[model samples]
Target: MALFEQIRVRLPRGARADAALAGGVFVLVAFPEGKLLGHGGDPLPSRVVSWLLVIVVCGALLFRRRYPVAVGWFTVVGTGAYYVLSDVDGPLVLVPIVALYAIAAQGRMQAAIAMAAAMVIGVGAATLTTASDVTGTAVFMLTGWLVAVVALGSGRHGRLAYAEEEARLRATEERLRIARELHDVIGHNISMINVQSGAALHRLKKDPAQAEAALSAIKAGSRDTLQELRATLDVLRRVDEDAPRAPTPGLARVDTLVGSANLAGLAVRIERTGAERALPARVDLAAYRIVQESLTNVARHSGAGHVTIRLAYGDRELTVAVEDDGRMTARPARPGGGSGIAGMTERARALGGELAAGPRPEGGFVVRARLPYGITGERWSGAADDQGPAGG
Candidate 1:
């Protein structure tokens, strides 16, 4: 049992292993088949040619994967030739059956069917009159075996195709998610710097100190943007690097985010409605991002004087809401469209949550996201809306 276990550990998986194991059985069975046919006036030949042909057919099957069609045809044609010349039963049936199965498993349906046809015709031409009923019985078995192999092979081929397609789809979705993260991280901060720089340039002569302040803000914003950008791009690295890494910002850093927006010239107030708790890394990151992106939209598009950032913890969900009383500016330039709303939606959906963003009927726009936490806040609390117009 130990020896068998050791051998089993080295076995290859799937169809290749199946072919190898079946090939061994066929080779061993060949000797008995030849001996059984060697009787009376129609004795099997003991010539060197007979053994060589059997070995050739068996050996050819080893390379079935690399050259499936060629190996299949060789085995089928070799079996026919051996029968015609030797007049003795051979393990030719197993050889062709195994070859056809390998061919179909390799997604060569046309070649497998063609090989089956050739085998039928070859058997008729070689054995019909000389062997009579034995020929019909062998052909009947071969016909049924070929049909089974084709069915099995076709199923295997389809499963592999589906698995490949699933892998490709997952990769595409990951790329889209990363793109959205980069856009939210870089786009908002860069846009803020652009606005600050323009303000500094306009106020340089009139208020040197104010211009200096704006420049200082731009410098600080640019630095933080680069740091977060580094963290985001770390995922794209193909080789190990020696650079230091930083922890990803989460709900813990919303204070710093609000401070940054305040510097970007948006007056803001934060509301924490429940006892704070640690969140799963992904949920935490998503929460921070939704807030950051909401404020970014306010800075770029909402002309409201004041904004509110609200974090409401719930028993099974955490809600992050950002609202402003500012007028909604025209849609900004977003690469994947819908002005960062779609990107935020994707993030929430990925985590089995949902997000909603639209203008409130009374006035200002709102962005609210609800993410599952399974621990936090009130049992049935929903995302908090602005009590009235935020900080009006």
Candidate 2:
């Protein structure tokens, strides 16, 4: 196998390579160094005719990849003609076998099988016509060789198809990841900027002092948006490994979210339960994004006065719930709403977690997510219903 790989690496590629290979094969069969294997009979034709037949049989291989099935049949019939015309039964037989493999490798299984069958039948008929002692064992061995060649070629085709499919799936997953990141980065900051700008416009004439403060907050929010946007784009444009990278958002930066929510006119409070411990990076990022998206939705839709964010760190999982004590405004969702709770749910589910968002019976809406540390083998042992505000 190592020698084969070395040869493959050194070989020329594409159509010219096939032409060179065909020429080499023709030379090996036509002018072998050793005596040629004969069919133990008197030659029935001229030596020139035999060489012409050899050329026709071996020359068909140059177009094997482009016209595999046609070349396969031509080589099969040509090999039989060569054996019948000349007493020589040499490496000329290898050309048809190579053509059969090419047919199978091009994903033409039925054509390869039919060709094999024809070749087997032709050989069996020739054994009957000639007085040679060709045994059943020889015929079976030839069939086995044909079967193995077809299997190898088909396996190569299957592996190539599987690699293509895997590449396509990875590309799709990357696209989805980029979409989610852009949505989270741009959606939240833009929501905050929109709210602050509205407040600034409303208070511009009645109270210029309050208007100035709102304008300042808007300016700051827009600047932060630009910085975060640049950071996100830098991550996407990662062409060099040694380049500086901003830290990914995680629960450690939840304070920044709270401060942003405070500026959005909602009093935000954070409560932690259970023993605080370090979380896996995926779980940490998922938890942060869930909370970030929930806060953005609350600021946009719910006219709430106070919001409570509860974080429960369990032995194997983490629960994050954002509840508000505000009026639940039944606003119709706009087309292509990025700040809705669906994106949060998708994030949680991607981490082997679940999220629930609904209007609480007591007051405003609530979003609860349960994220697991490891998403394999063991199932989550925590109580399933504890993801709500009442339990967590």
Candidate 3:
């Protein structure tokens, strides 16, 4: 088997040479009487013609691999002619067998079968005409050549199957990797914004001056978050030339997001807990989207008068929760009921995190998500607050 594998590897460049050498050897061995110089006890022109036939048969063997179908037919004709003219069993007769196997391996099964049939008919006719004892030779050659074609074809198909399976596995792995990165970028940002926005609102009643500054900070933070998201999305979209340019929103932008809801006459509140820390880009992005999608759902379905968003960071994970105090009966059915929920679930699942969204026991609807910190053990620290809130 190892020797056969080595020969198969070398066959691409060496097949033609091998065929020529084998035919030369056959000619020398078959015409041991010095090319039949004399016939019926005297020299004749037929002797020279017979030698020429051997040369033609050997020459035809050189082109088999480059054009296997043509070579098979040429060999069939040449071998039959040589068998009749020279009364010789030349090695050129095996050319069609190799050519048929090549054709079948290359997915040309019908052509290979046709050539095999031609070989059988030609060999049978030549054997009958010459009255030679070729019955065993003919049977062995036909059966062996057919088996070789079937084996080669099956091997080629198996190789293709393996290649396809490998490609599929690679594609699946890539998708999982991308999903993890996306979760890290989006999750952390949304948590931070939700926290800060809630703090700003709480301080509004106590100090109007600080409230104005906080609102301004919120707008700037939201804008910055959107820009950063756009940049990250651009990198992910490298494979798509026509992908749209849309910025991603992060948690720092929750105030502006909630403000928009306020403008639409929905009362929204945001709150945060724990010491604020800078998160990886993926976590920030996921956090922002969770809040954003939650608020969007509230606007679309709920006739809620108030919505509350909360963000909390523990030692190992970040959690986000959004709830509304709207009456369930007042909420309308979502235009496409399950699509938004499915999309949200898919987004959360991609990040290697968990999301929960449904009606709250007290009243209204709720969305909760928890994302793990320390992606692959990479720790993220808080950035300096020197820049404006919009500079994330």
Question: Of the candidates shown, which would achieve the greatest lDDT relative to the real structure?
Answer: 2
Candidate 1 lDDT by residue in tens digits, 58-157: 7787777678899899988887777767655656667878788778887999999999889877776656567454557877886787788888988998
lDDT of 2 by residue, 1-392 (tens): 99888788566778987798789888888775125534344354545667788888888888887888999999999988877876565668788898888888878999999999998888888888887567678878989999999999899989888999987976676566666666776777788778767777888899898778877877777787787677656655765454333455678989888887776677999999999988876777778878887787788878887999999999989999999977873433635755367767777776678899888888788888998878642222211211101100
TM-score of every model? Answer: 0.73, 0.85, 0.46
Ranked by lDDT, the better of candidates 1 and 3 is 1
lDDT, candidate 3, 1-392, per-residue tens: 99887778543347757576546645664565363454354345555555676566556557655776786677667667766765434454554555566667766667777777777776677577767778868667766767777578757867877888987876775554344333333433343355447657877799776667667655765665676566656555567364333434467767767765664446888788997787655566667667776776676567688999999987777888989977763334344333445545555555567788878889898888877664442221111111112224
TM-score of 1: 0.73
The reply for model 2, stretches above 4 Å from the true place, is: 1-11, 31-45, 207-209, 234-244, 329-334, 337-339, 377-392
By TM-score rank, best first, the candidates go 2, 1, 3
Mark the regions of model 1 whose C-alpha exceeds 4 Å error after superposition: 1-67, 92-94, 117-128, 132-152, 238-246, 333-339, 374-392
